[model samples]
Each structure stands twice: as structure tokens, then as C-alpha cells.
Target: MEENLRNNLIDKLQNNTISSEEREELFKLYNSYQFSKEWNENTMGNFEDVRKKILKGVKLKRNGASRGKIYAINSFLRIAAACLLVFFTGWLGYTLILKPDPNVIVESGKSRKEVVLPDGSKITMNINSTLTYPRVFEAKRREVKFEGEGFFEIQADRSHPFIVATPHVKVRVLGTAFNLKAYKEDPAIETSLIHGKVEVLTAKEERTLSILTPNHKFVVDKIALITSHLPQTKSQIEVVPMEFIDPSNTAPVDLAWKEGKFAFASSPFQDIAREMKRRYAVDIIFENKEAADFKYTASFEQEDVVDILDALQLVKPFKYRKEGNKIVVY
Candidate 1:
């Protein structure tokens, strides 16, 4: 009799004809009874579709329901669905629904995205970047994991330091504005300070690589850090003055990308190609090693990929042929 009543309630719910009393009864029945193996096998094939229909049907039927009743029913149904998923889908549902990570932020394709952290710090993420941080920062320090590139304007908090961890180096700052470039494929990790102070540290925080000031850049060579054998006392970081778009204006080239500008300062041809690939969502193929190693210094705004390539050709002779979304340069 209980099994028949439960099946009847489920059928009513699926058909969008379940009454308020029936919904309440169904909620209680779901808690008490385990679903049959045959029913689970049949429903598993269209789980997502069934889940969507169930929620949509409930929402449509709740037009005249009281707020308190609606809340109770909605909460119960969500839990019931989760229970069903746990039994039917096994670990996939448990990981995605129950033990989900709430703050793994990702930006894909060729557009930049701005994210405001819990402490009111703003991060402008470049194309193809990921940043992970807790929903609420810890009491001692505000820490985040980052890769690709981003422009950070951190909120000032002397008590709680802001830390950014990348593959090669860890950056610690009290409160500072800086641009970090740490693409996994790139040979070096770069931190360009715009204002305030920041300390670049080794992977384990054992050594201070460099302390950056305004208009300065700190670079870490990944190959050198990996291949070195001796106990070196000197810092392995290269500190350089930030590249300017023009000497007269005093505007640093590093911050240009956030403003929709593509700037490079005597950057290798391959690096330029990589930047273009991210900005334009295209692939660049080098036919010759010499072409790939050619150094170029230029800044561009409001130009298409082909136009930029044409401009580069004027500076140095190179032949390139377009093949769909890719450009092959020789």
C-alpha cells in the first residue's frame, strides 16, 4: 500500500498534477523509502531532463502557494533530487553537488573579465586565465591561486597581506597595484608593479627573489631556477624599469593590455605571436626558426590581426599566408 501510494505521488509530480497535500506526502515518502532498481535504471538515462522538468513543474504549480510552504517544498525537493543523484550517478553527483568548490573562477576564449574579491580587491583577468580563492578571506592573510595573466588593484589592509601564488613565484603585498604574467607555457614569470610595494618569493618562501617598487618589473627565469646546482646567495630575479609606450608620457607598456591595447617591447616574435593568439583567438605557425626568434617592439590599438601582421612586415621582411583561423609565417 505504501509502495503504491509513493509511485502514485511520483507519477503525479512528474505529470505536474501533484496537489499541495500530495507534495507534502511525497516528501515524507521519499525520506522513508528507497527507490527500486528498475525505476532507477529507467530514470538514469534522462536524469538531467527529468530533474529540469520536476523543478519547472513545481515552480509552475507554486503560483498560489504560501511563501513558507513554498520554501519548505522547494528545499525538500532539492534534497530529494540530490539523494536520487547520489544513488544513481554515484561519485559524479557527490563531487559536483555536495562537495563543490565555490571559488574556482575561470575566463576562457579571447575576452578579459573583471572579478571583485571578498575584500573589495579588483582583478582584471586576461584572456585564458584562472583564479581560485575562498569566498571569504582568512583572518591573517588573503590568498589566491592564479595563472595566465591579470591586473590586480588590491585593497589596502596592513594587517592582512594579499598573496598571489603562481607556478614559479609567490607574490606578497600589503596593498598594491600590479600586473602579473605567468602563463604555464611561458619560460619566465613576470610581475610589473604599478604602485605600492610587492615582494616576489621563491616557491617555498625560503628566498626573497626581489622587492618591486613603482614602475619596476621583476622577472624569474624558470629554466635557471630548475637547472641551478650551487647554493647561490644572489637573487635569481631580474629587476628592470617598466617599458614605456613613449618616454614623454611616462605610461608603462605593461598596463596597456587592460585598456584594449597590444604592446610589446623588443619581445621575441614567438612571444608576440602568443599574445596575438590570445587577443585574437587565432593560431600562429612559424615556418622557420629565424622568423620565430626575430625581436620586435611595437604597440597597437584598434587593428585587426592581419593589419598588425602587415605592420610587422614593414619593419622586417617576412612572408605569411593565412589558412582559415591560423597564420603560417616563414
Candidate 2:
């Protein structure tokens, strides 16, 4: 009677009309084969190899037995392949569902992008900059991550502190306007507070470097601290306090981007080139090291890259040429 039942199931599987009850029975048989001592003793290999081994083993066991047993073994092989296909399909579906999507992302390529956060805070991202935040602000505090440069105008919310996190440092503020510059390739991280108050801290140790006030810029020389032989402590890190250029001016130098202008005061030529690169999305190469070492105090309003470079030349005797997307200075 068992032989007749097995033969009927095998016929149904071969004809592609196997019933649900027959599939359950086949699963039980497959499980038994999987946990058997013979299966465990066999060295594990690829799925194909394992399937072949199982088929070979079943055939050998029923050799010279009866035709019904041989048919049952073939039926098991078909079911095993179907089970493997289903397993992979289910796994692929699970992975797709679990993948995460960026809740809020702002990217500025050759131009700037203005983003308003959920808490009514506004951020103006500079060229080649990126800012990411969650879809909703957390109950306790509002947090966001940033790369490159951004000017933030945060709404007043003393109850919930707003935090901006970067690779090198973190800035915490209740309600204030500030500018943060933290590029991965840059050697320093700069935070300039325009109004209200903010606290800057190192990312690694969460050590508060300084509490900044309006019109003050805080600079952390990361390379100098890392290479220095001094004791590696929060106290040893070099934090420079520099005053914004022309406080009497309507907009401080740090906030010049908001007015479509670039301002600098006694800034190194190399540093100017870096700022030009960020603003124009073009490369500024210095062919002469001496030219790069010069310092200039200047500002440009709504000027193109060539115009800015020409203005710099008026202050200092230097030559520049444009080659495609790069400006070569000598």
C-alpha cells in the first residue's frame, strides 16, 4: 500500500499536477534525508554538488529494489530544485525590503542649494556640499550630518538643542546663525558664529573645544595636532580665534556667500585658491610655489572666476591662464 501511494505521488509530480498534500509528504521525506547520518557525514559543497550527491545516494540505496523506489527518488530531485529556487527568491525579497533610503538629502554640485529642515531651520549648502537629516526631528533634540560647507540659520528653540555633526567636529546650538566648513581633504575645520551662541566639540572625544560668540571664528588645525609630538589631549589641540573681517560691514566676511560675494583679509594665496575651487567648481593650480605663498586682502562681488583672479593680480604681480576647467597661476 505504501508503494502504491509513493508511486501515485511520483506520477503526479512528473505530470506537474502534484497536490498540496503530496508536496507536504515530499517535504517530510526531504527533511529526513537532510538530517540523516549519511547527509551529515558528507563534506558540504555547493548546492548543485549537494543535490547531485543526494540523488546519487538515493539511487544507490534503492538499486535492484523496485521501480517505485526509483521513481520516488527522481520525484525528490525535482522537489529539491524547486525548494532551492524558492529559498533564493524569498531571500532576495527580504533584502530589498530591509534596505534603507536617505530620509532627507541636499546636494549642491556646481551651484548652491537652500534647504529648510522640519524645525523651520534653514541651511544654504555650498557647491560640492552635502547635508543629510532625518524625515522627522527627534523629540529630545534635532540632529543632522553634513559634509563640505553650509550656512545655517536655526530657529529659536531653547528647549531642544539643534546639533550639526561632521567628520571632525560637532556644533550644538539652541538658536543661532553660523557657518561650518569641514571638507574631508581640508586640514582644518572652521566654525564661524554670526549671532547667538554655539559650542564646538571634537568628534572623537566629544571634548568641547570652545564656546563661540557672534563675529568670532573658531579654527581647529587637525593636521597640526595629529603630527605634533605633544601629549594627545583635548587641551593640546590648537584652537585659533580669529575675528571676522570688517565688522562694520553689513555682512561679515564669513557670511559673504549669502550676498553672492567672496571676502578675505590677509588670506594666503593657496587658501584663496581653495575657496575659488569651492565657489566656481573649477581647479586652481599654482605653477609657482612662490605665487601660492603670497597673502592678499581682497573681496569680489558677483564676479566670475577670471574676474576674481584678475583682481588678485592687480594687488600682487602674478600671471594666470585658463585651460578648460582649470586655472593655472604662475
Candidate 3:
């Protein structure tokens, strides 16, 4: 083979791409290369290591695998990572299931919705999230109740702190973008900050005062008066001081729902049903107990309940039927 052929082969091999014949040709060429043995020792390794490294590094974009075989290495690692990406149907699912706001966001279902509020935090409820709030608020004390969830970029008026109160806890924020999860049956209340500061208060006690900067988060236990705060700063710029919630590291994932999508994080079936009912304008009732425990972690956009049920069946097999306006999950 010519030098150019060798170079091209090297490129493909490095990128984990080769046809059956190409693989055989590459094996012969790679061995013939100068110091090729050393190169192999240094570059190539078991597939698992490669896959973990790749998956951990770049989150491939959705829109099907047009990623070519570029920058890939032929190893079990590539196979595993590619399998995961393919299994999920793509990498980055911009189109997500507009899940119920964990805090209190009323979602419009297959119909138009208008959400009036106490402090004039007017939110236009989209299909699928049942949101409830007080008609008003008082000073040194601000509370609005909600179920499901919503993506909020609060209108800042620092004097009256905006608190999205649920039965379990409250997510308080002033002038910032974030997503909250306070479903009725969830074991914990999760608040993720996309920008700005927020505090989660329980038992009306603000001790240690879980203060969260951007990208940082504070999750409160539903029953227990405890709080959990994860590290938010970057690992590389440790010396440099900056605050932002790393969407790449938080769970219940990012909030692309308001933009019309559903984003779940291994959430319970019941919670998922509640979100669907609000968004699709259809009711999701559990017909079977076994299905309720089924957990899911995926995203979609304006998907019907059948698709949702199909996804649920992936984790926990069950039966179901439709009852007029409701989905009976058995």
C-alpha cells in the first residue's frame, strides 16, 4: 500500500471505522507501519474503556447517526457507546416530553390554557401540566402552591420573594430561570437552577440556608427536614471563581420542556402519568399496580399516551386499555 493509503487507513482505524475487508487490510497495514506496535500499545485498548471515555466526553447530537465514523476507534467501547446512543434513538433529544413541573406549573392539554397568579406571575399553561397557585401573596411571606412542574424565568421584584410552594416544600427564587419537580407522590422535591439563585425551605426553617448559585441545586426531602447541595463549579477552573448549574451533571436532566418537550429522569410511572394528563389533555389512570412501579428516563415532544405507554412497557411489562378520555395502565 502507498503512504496515502496507510494514512487514510490510520484515520479510519483511529475513528473505529472499517468494513470487513477494510479491517483485514488495516491489520496488515498497521503492523507494517513504523513503530506501529508502539502506536497500537499507546492508542488502542479494550472497548469498554473507550466507550466510557467517549460517552463521558461528547454527547453526540440527535438526528440519527450521521456522525460518520470520524474520531472513532474500533473497540468494544465504541460499540457500547454507539449501542447506547442508538438504543436511545439518538444522542441529544432536543424534542422532549413537557413533563409536569415538579413545583407548580399548570400545563395546557390538547387545548389552550391561561394561568392567573397571586403576584402576577402570569404563566400560559401549555398542554399537559396541572399547575395550581394562590390568587395572591403577602409581605415577609410569599407562597404559591402547585403540582406537576413548570419552567420559569421569574419577573424580578426582590421585595416580594417568589416562592413556588407545593404540599411538601417550596422553591424560592428571584429573577432567574429554572425547573422544579414537586409531583404529588415523589419521595423528594427537586429544584434545579438554570440561572440565578434559589433556596428550598422545609418546616418553614431556613437553617444552613441551602444557598444555590447558577447551575447549583438544592433538593429537599419530602418528609425529612434535610437538604442536599451538590458541587456546581467547574473542575478545571477551580482557582477561578464562577457560579453556574452544570446541566451536564444534574439529574432530572435539563428543562427543555417549556420549549415543548418532555424530559424525565428515571421517574416513577405515576408521576409520568400526571404529567401526560396535563400536557396531552388526556387522563392517565393506573389500571394495574405493577405498572405504577415502572420507571422511565426519556424525553419527547407532544407524544400521545400510547407512545408513553409503549416506552413504559420497555422497563416493566404490563397491559392497558383506553377509557374514553383516560389511559388505563394495567
Worst 10 residues of 3 by lDDT: 233-242
Arranged by lDDT with the best first, the candidates are: 1, 2, 3
lDDT digits (tens) for residues 1-330 of candidate 3: 455675565556557674445545555554454625344434455434543433332333221233444434446578988899886764344324443333444555565355656565655444444766544454665656666555666777788788776676667777676666666655655666777887766535444335666765455555454323333321211111222223555433545455566767666788777767656667777768777877877777777678877876777788888889877866
Highest TM-score scorer: 1
Off by over 4 Å in 1: 1-104, 227-236
Clashing pairs in 2: none
Query: Each model's TM-score?
Result: 0.67, 0.65, 0.45
Ranking by TM-score: 1, 2, 3
Better of 1 and 3 by lDDT: 1
Name the better of 1 and 3 by TM-score.
Answer: 1
RMSD (Cα, Å) of candidate 1?
A: 22.0
For each of the candidates, give the backbone clash count: 0, 0, 42
lDDT accuracy of residue 76 in candidate 3: 55
